[model samples]
Target chain A: MTKSKPLPSLIAVIDIGTHKTVGLVGQIIDGKARMLSFSERRTEGVVKGTVVDLEKLHNCVHEAVNDLERVAQRGIEEVYLTIAGPSVAGERVKGFVAVPAHDGKVTARDFNEAMLSAKRLEPPAGRATILYMRQPTMLDGKSVENPVGLQGKRLEVNFWRVTMEEGNVRFRVNMINAMSIHVRDFILASHAAACALISEAEKQGGVLVVDFGAGTTDWILYFKGHILCAGSIPVGGEHLTNDLSVALRISRDTAEDLKVRFGSALHRETDANQTIWKDGDKGVGDQQFNRGTITQVAALRFQETLEFVRKDVLHQLEQIFPGHAVKLDQNFLPSGAILTGGTANLADAAEASTNVLGLPTRVGIPQFEKEAYRKPEYAGVIGMMKAAIEDAPPPVRRPQGTLAWLKDMFRF
Target chain B: MNLFTRLRQFFSPRRDAFMGPADREWRQLIPQDVRRMPGDELGRKRAARSRLPLVLAVIFFATLGGIVWVSIDDTTAVVAGNGALRYKTDGFYPVPDLQRLVGQGKDGAAKDVAAIKADLEMDTQIASADVRRRGDGSLEIILRERKAVAKIASLPGSGPMVVRLVSPEGVQFSGAGYPSEAIRNLPEIIDYRTSGSGDKATIEGIEVAGPFLLAAQSAYPNLYREWSALSLRDCFGAQEDSPGSNLRVAVRRASQPADRPVLTEIVFSTANWRNELAILSRLDLDGLLRRPGITAPAYVLKLSIQNRTSARPVPEPRLVPATTR
Candidate 1:
């Protein structure tokens, strides 16, 4: 008799962005992600990554999930969700514990105590921490990757904690629960994008990742194989479209079409003399607009967004390393910056980022087994899958003793 | 607690403060309202699909439990028979006598099945007992009785002498329900040592003598019929390979004619009794006694002792005059 093959472990992830919501079902086979099904629908009732009308968003999300289940032929019980916006931010905290061993050698227990102490630093009032990224363990004022079996009088540890507004998380949880799917985890959008688009070598050599969505911009900075900071700003490609719509005296739809067709984040010498028609065929009510003006409007807004991200990174760095002076240059970040997300499709986005952030920049497309998923727009969801698999928690072990067993039996 | 306070607490959402490095990332943020609310059509369909396997599992487990319950139920009747206790045996144990042995009352109330089986197996005549309760509130019992290998005559401290049968495993039991001719045909054990009293009595050295007699009766019945009594005076307990241990069987003289010299007794070594019996079966005792020079009225056959003066100890049956033995 032939042996039957075991079924693959499938993971479903959903990215709820301002412009569109995407749902994907995939499984990692032999260290490569095998895409099973992909579905996306236009988002509604959400603005700047905050839900305004939960019912409308639920309808859209419900349809997208249904489409995924129908094509994949598997029911999703829980899903990893990617969260972004102004409310999601990162902060650095430090904790130290005195070595208590008789030999004065730092042990795993000392390391754990230091981490626990660092995590005890509470988040701002209405937010909840989602993840704790460890920096490095310090032994006697010197940084060490692993402190165990090393002689030290004190052990110090630093963590970059990511927190989100508790109310926002609750809303998303309730929405997904309404569809009978539990929210398994909340992944920071920038973190997920970095996991998908950035390589380990780049992270080790210090790199920056910026994801430009429709209504929000999320960015993360990595230096010396550790995350320095991550934050999201509520300004993105839609602001550029609005800027064009208000300056060129055109409809928003025409402005969006022009932005996609002719908009550029960098100005060219020939843009002044060139003109682009809203409708190429010159149909009825079609209008003409200066290409230079469109490029100027988009470039200004894009530059401003990148500058904001640059300032945030510098400020966070200054706070982390108080006495040291840091600069955003090639020497500081050798791997430069990688740009991804839907808005990264704009022409010369990398050039604009390079100009504004003072680092070599390039548009990042996620690598997948399937050619269809290797696109800038799918980076966030794909990264969410990767992060979900890599950072999956260990299985909970049942407690011993009769009372614990009885309690477990009665637990729903 | 007040109703309003309880309601507020019930609707409150779950919040996690800080996630340490050791904390799990996949813990759910459950809200009371979400858990209490019903799901959509697709969720309902999925739930229904999941319930199918659970239902089948329940059905399978229920069937298994029912079978086990029926097998161990003491009140269930034996459907094959019309009584509370159904006795099946190859021996002469009557139902009433067996019930009395197991201490069952006449009212036929249900008793513990394990206790009844243990009581039945305690009897010396029974080798094994299987007692089960059927689905019709009756007990079904099947018994295996031990066969008599030889007879032992014992005189208790306060009773008349009684003749009991010995099994191949050295168990002594009253030869109940056996034909008088069959009992009389069995060779009596003499000069045997025994311990204990009554039903628990065990004969010493019966381990060797009992199996020998059984083997002779089974494989060499024609040679076995001439044996009258067996003496274990030289046989040691559980030491069948000892050189000095031997079993002596007295030959019946009634079958021999008055004018002819007859063989009286056969001696077999305990160590190689089986081989000695096989050799004795092939020998023509009448022809040997009729040799021209033999003049003794009775001769003793010694099949146990070997001639050891040569390089190899060779076993050869030797006949000696009864007076010399």
Candidate 2:
């Protein structure tokens, strides 16, 4: 904030997930995010989205970022990050201000006053607000797109605020800072993923975005074209793997393999007597597991995770629209629910989401010019890149003097 | 929804929580500097790191090669005296002398230049000289001449009054080789300044007189040129640290035998010639000479013991007519 830097063309994004840390380089060319370099490494010492061991996470980050920088032939100084931890939460806050202009026309100053007033509304103790998305503005109790140059006695602004635990944010920040890089901003992994997968039309209508990461499930509700509610559930694909291990008497690693190999959420829809281990995928474990049993163990845990996400989102929505049967309203999610993230690739993940939420559901994958970008796993990083550009300040054009103009013209 | 699943979800520890030592190993071994130089952390590592040794090798050899080339190469220099290669002192330093010394080969060029400088500086005409060799294979020899600051005027009835030039360093030489006009313009050293014919040697007591003449001539050249001669009788305040001896100076008109000389004598006990000469130069000698009833061929202008000027015309014999009155 104390200095001005030249605008950079290459955008670097780091997505630290529970199982994998991804670093990618891209540039906005012709209104498309074109991937330049991409790198991925197994994340270490991170549980869910929280980095418990700073050093392990730092190495994981360094390996991925270093490889990307090597391939790009340039160093990265500043980057945007997508973080998902149990500390993520959201709140709806509002503020109002009287017009200061003599003619009662609203100005930027009035809008800023309202915004500051709303943000200063006490956040939870030991927590800091990281992001805020503005809702529709009200000019003298009348909703308007732009209050500027409009006659209004008072102006009010609403914000959906995202706050994170101070200690966890610091841990994530230090992991990146130790590598001598600057964190331009921290975005929630779900928001970033949703930004990538959700279309503009889907966002404008009501929709639900669920990013199923390895250790955490992040869900955000978009109602009336605004981010109405968002929450992070401390349960994800890893929990289902653990359940499968405990129920089937298998190692956690073997459980993960089983979950990836044969786990399906729509277990009841498949043949219950189908044998899971008949193909002899491994020579060491000679036990046969019925397809129904694999589904029964994994689906139970995955179903529980979906239930938690649904319950938390409903609770937040009820707080917003009190005394109103919000779910009963037919236009709750016109675009339905869109799922993404590492766990979103799980078999029958959409079916489980649809059965629980009672809405049309589909797995989301971010599409870009590079084929590597069009996958659920890449949704967070690509979306973070898109969001970072949107939040960047416009480039400054310095007025050139006569001498500078001549020098520029004659430069070889 | 059983108690087992609830407890497991509540107390699930992050994976690899016990691998602190392993993480430390990676932290220590990671190549922190993988980029190049002259850029940010990444840029510097990328640009400067991998080929650093190769770049250093190139720089080291380049410097060593330049030094070796300069040490072995033969540099020519122009040898000159004053502003030109030829000097007023003819045959002072010819090209053969330069070629014989510095042109032998590329070796010992510094020694050759020093020898040439010492040889030219030994000439009486040259006060100091410099011999330098340049980087472009050339040599330069510059000479400085000691200007004639004082003149020895021959006494009257001394065979047409020949003039002699005294160097600023107090060496007196016959003015036969110099133009008369230049010799005539110098401040004169009159009585007590003498030399045997063809001696070409300086008169004694010039050490004190030489600097005084030089400083006076430089400061008051216009006035110094008008004077016929500065009588050097008893100058230097006697010999051998003799204090309290009076030094008498008489400045005479320039030589134009048709006109009688304007005579003025100043006596001083100190060699404060600068102040004394400045005061003397300001006196209107021509105005004083043309004053009414002043028809004497010589006069004495004494600087009083207190350093003041007072004049007296020389006494003339009265003529008596041998006739019956």
Candidate 3:
């Protein structure tokens, strides 16, 4: 918000997921984002949305950040954190008030009141919280999508608010900042996942964001420009591979490789002819799994997990906008579901998800025109960086007030 | 009748059987050998020594007559533009500077005399020049042209180059300064090994005039009539340490207009004048001129031939026109 020109500054992101921790440094050079350096390492001490070992998690974040700093030739000051966990929660909250009769002018204070009323929902205990809030519609005696620069008698708000455990976010930020880097902003993984996969129009046109991460799947439904609902399922990509290893009695590593390289989630044309080569182990000679058998085993696990996710997403959508006759495959949402996250890379997952959920679907990679984000996996981290840069107050100002309010409106 | 008649003619002795009266006259022409006195050997030796000049005189007269006949009959008047402007009695006439040979004059001795006087004032070095007529109507020129022992290439834009003239002896004179004219189109001898203006050069022992003369003599031997200009540039010698010790001369061809050789580079060592001449005789100047491929001397006439060097195609011998001016 500083009117003074933004100096050539760097923004870094540390994405510490259960499977991997990645650090990326980007510079704003000549008004364009340029990649300065990037580093990634396998993560430990965290699994299934909870930190099992805090010390190990700290070390993982430290090593990746240090490498990024060295390669970028500059010390990292702060990092935008990407948070993904099962305790995160979302719901649609709306508020409305009659416009002042004499003045009939809806001021900035009125907008703030509506948003505060929406965040009034108390979070459950033992879960620290971070908020993703948005105002979708304004009804000043009439339902309007844009309230800005409009004269109105009454202002009503339709907004989506997501709350997650604040302790986990604080820990993640504090861990990175402990290495002398500040956590500029914390972005809930699902929203960052959604930003990477879907476009602005899809959110307005009713789309589902299914982020299939390790040990969990985060699902959010968007319709009419607001997140109608969000939910998480415990079964994710790791569960499917675990089920394969247990049922087939193979090594975990082999099960993972076979699942990725020879995995199929649907009975399709290519699946009919597919043959998976099984390296001889455990006294079993080299063998092959025909397409039908491999699909039977893989799809049995993946399909059931997807069914559970589909049911939750559908139940939430119906609860939010009742009597709207929102069929899972209804044409009201021209664009269907957008599936992202690491596990969504599985072959035919989109088709399998569409088949189980009875809706169209496609896999999504984070799309960034910024040169720093040439890789799609870094989408969540970069989204957080952008969010931090936007939220920071103008360096010359009091660091509070309407400019900060204006900044929030732009946040994903 | 035979015996008495024969005896009668023999008695008269005018009718000797083996001798005709004309033959007797020829016999009288041959004097009889006289027997010398016992101590006359010493006297006769002295006498022979005294008569030796008379014997040389008879032979000298005969040789003189023959030489005169050959000079008068064989030598022809050459109406060249340089020097006294008239023909030399001996074909060997000197045109100090060939460029001055350009001018028009009348047909007879009057015109020749005018050309002579004009030429006299032109070159200060010329002591005198004369035009003499031979018996065969060929003019003999007795020219004491300025002895510009060195020749310099004074071509309009190029720097001057020089060459040494080899006289009766192979030793070169390093006295006279650089000559700016005679070696007009000679390839300059350069030692690229050195820096600055260049090493001083000369032609034919007259220090300044020598280089131009050498260039003229050497290049003229292989060049055609169209020669326009010459350059003398020093090139790096094959050896590195002993700089200024080894040098070579490069000759440019007249038919080619470029100062540098466009066809072939011809290089010959200064130490091998005779060898260079030998190789020069083998150059087919006329053939090279006639061929469209021989564009310039750079590509064809490579004089840098040695035992270790690969043998290259030698053009046929050049039959240079015998105009020596």
Candidate 4:
């Protein structure tokens, strides 16, 4: 059946990062998020999600937003922003307290105190917190959905924390404010994307999300419907392109073109007499080069990236629980891992990730209407929109007047 | 030595100490000459508010005056013939011919705008036309022409059948001002039982059903290709006895496997075509061909009888043999 689309109010969301800038206009129809327009351009005057050159950044954002407004045939006044930079980091805090001393059922105040104990901290001098998620509470020795009426001695609450550099965020916010648009909220891109790529069942069973972009690779861990860790690495797919450029002795633009058209993360047998596209007297797309070399370079870099990402995740887990010896393998994890973002489209990227992490892995794409969710790159923006919809205030209820009351009393 | 003081000191190293927060380097995007006119603070403020509209008004009046002067001076222009006109203007009658519109044997002020509008309205093809004088004194005509809704043949004429293009406003044209594709592809309204001299009067339901046919044809051309004709015999009245004969439309069905075409008549209710087509779209017509005891080369579907959704196909009568086989 064809889905019915009603006229819906539009909401704008922007993802400004190191490699590219994207603007999206979305709407909520029948409580489902739908994308109306998508516009993207190369990053300008920005480094690792920080505004470095103000004038150039202004022009870049103005052009991106203007193009989206034209495509959607509307104006944008507010935006939901996504942040992915080196300064973004996640921490977990666990608080424990006795249930109560009295006989009356453990009051809601006791539960609130237990949960807020872990949240009572000033963000470090220049850092600002973005999100705090609470996991299912532990009563005595077992996890319980609600422990108010149950008899228990011990109550422990765990919260996942995400924070970023305050000055950097404010600078970008100031720039956006100058353009006459309000910033609704800021989210870590990987944290927001976890909502779109991972299902509730997978989250309850524990899953890992790895988002790969051109300049940065972000990872987030969620288990039991709550986040545990999230972080970003400085290196990403750009390193692979740079590696190919140097190894082939070709320009960066040509290397990128060749990498996309011929490169694969899985190696295959090469024909000794066969030659593939390389520069020559022939025109572009006619030039000849060795196809095997392209795949080899891609495979080698992918192997290195998988190893680095695995080590990073393992190291963060160790820090979260110093003495527990958390195993980063299939034996400990049941839901496995989901990969998303631009680099997830690389051939054999999922297989290489599985091999390195020792877990089942698959590429992740948002589950929305196909026309809107055409690519995995939209996972972050779509997730942010879902988050916005959940956060919107409820509709107001009007009071009935005396005239209506009289009419009901006089009904035949 | 305290933490707050030390943290403040560490972060404050050369953080644009002298310049204010609002001060940016690229604030000067305007050229030097433009900046010179609004050099000082008050002058810049005044120029920004006052000089813009003054400059715009000067430009607007200057352009408007130039066009007026050119149109008033030119005198050699005149309305051209129907050959020079873009659309078909054949058999012009109540619509004055080109000779009258061009004001032959009349003065220069002849052919005013209202007269031209009235003359154009006399014909069925011209819906409405906005006539204006161009900058070079020639008549500029922008027309909203009447499109052919269906090709209808109602009353008997000199030929075997009188087929004319029926417009949306329920007017007939003698095959004028329409392209060949329109004449060929428009729905055929043949075998219509009505009487009149084909004046500026309308038979009911033609205008209403016209839109539904156009929409159905555009939406489902492959399905529309199956129907050949519609016989409007007492279509306006409610039918109690012979409802099937009240409204008739021809259709073609293909027998499976052999893919042989069988022509048949389908009787349907006089509802909107879209609604009736929706009912037809949901019907499993092919499933009826394989029903028990159904063996016939061709048959008629009585759709108007029962639940219109379930059309019953009647098998053709077979001639019983006189001799025992």
Model 4, runs deviating above 4 Å: A1-9, A48-51, A269-274, A279-281, A284-287, A370-373, A391-412, B1-325
Candidate 3, lDDT over the whole model: 0.57
Task: Sort by lDDT, best first.
Answer: 1, 2, 4, 3
Q: Which candidate gets the maximum TM-score versus the true structure?
A: 1
* lDDT tens digits, residue span A1-412, model 2: 6665345476789988888888888755544566778998998988866767876776678778778877776566667887676877788988889897888988887887888777667666666567777777888777787788899898888888877776666666655666665566777787788888887788888889998888899888876666778888988888888888898888899888888888887678554768767348757756788778888887778788888888888888789879976781237788999888877788988998888877888999887777756889788888888777776642233454686556644543
**TM match of model 2 to true structure:** 0.57
TM for every model, in the order presented, reads 0.58, 0.57, 0.49, 0.52
In terms of lDDT, the poorest run of 10 residues in model 1 chain B is B23-32
Candidate 3 regions exceeding 4 Å error are A1-5, A140-142, A148-153, A268-275, A279-291, A368-379, A382-412, B1-325
Q: DockQ of each candidate's interface versus the true one?
A: 0.08, 0.02, 0.00, 0.01
Higher-ranked by DockQ: 1 or 3: 1
- Model 3 CA lDDT for position B35: 28
**How much is B27 displaced in model 1, in angstroms?**
5.3
Q: Write the per-residue lDDT of candidate 3 for residues B155-254, one digit (tens) a residue.
A: 2256553343222112222213334354343233232222222222222212222333355455554442233322223322222223232233333443
Going through the candidates in order, what fraction of the true interface contacts does each contain? Answer: 0.17, 0.00, 0.00, 0.00
Q: What's the CA error at residue A25 for candidate 1, in Å?
A: 1.2
Q: Which digits, one per residue and each the tens of the lDDT, describe model 4 over residues A1-412?
A: 9888655666788877666778888766777766778888887887644567987876687667766766775556567788886877677767777866677366677787787666665455456566676666888878887877777788878777677676666666766665555566666798777877887888888888988877788888876776777778776777778888998888888878877777776767863245676655588555567877777887788767777778888898898778988888766668998888777778778888888778899888887665655566778777777767765532223234686556544543
lDDT by residue for model 1 over A1-412, one digit each (tens)? 9866544677889999999999988865544457888999999998877778988898899888878877877667678898899878788888999999999998888998898898777677667667788786789988799998999998999988887777777778878887667677778899899999988899989999999999899999988888888888899888888999999988888888889999998988789899888777899887888899999898889899999989988988898889999999999999999999888989999999999999999999998777877989889998988888777742233464687746644553
lDDT at B59 for candidate 4?
94
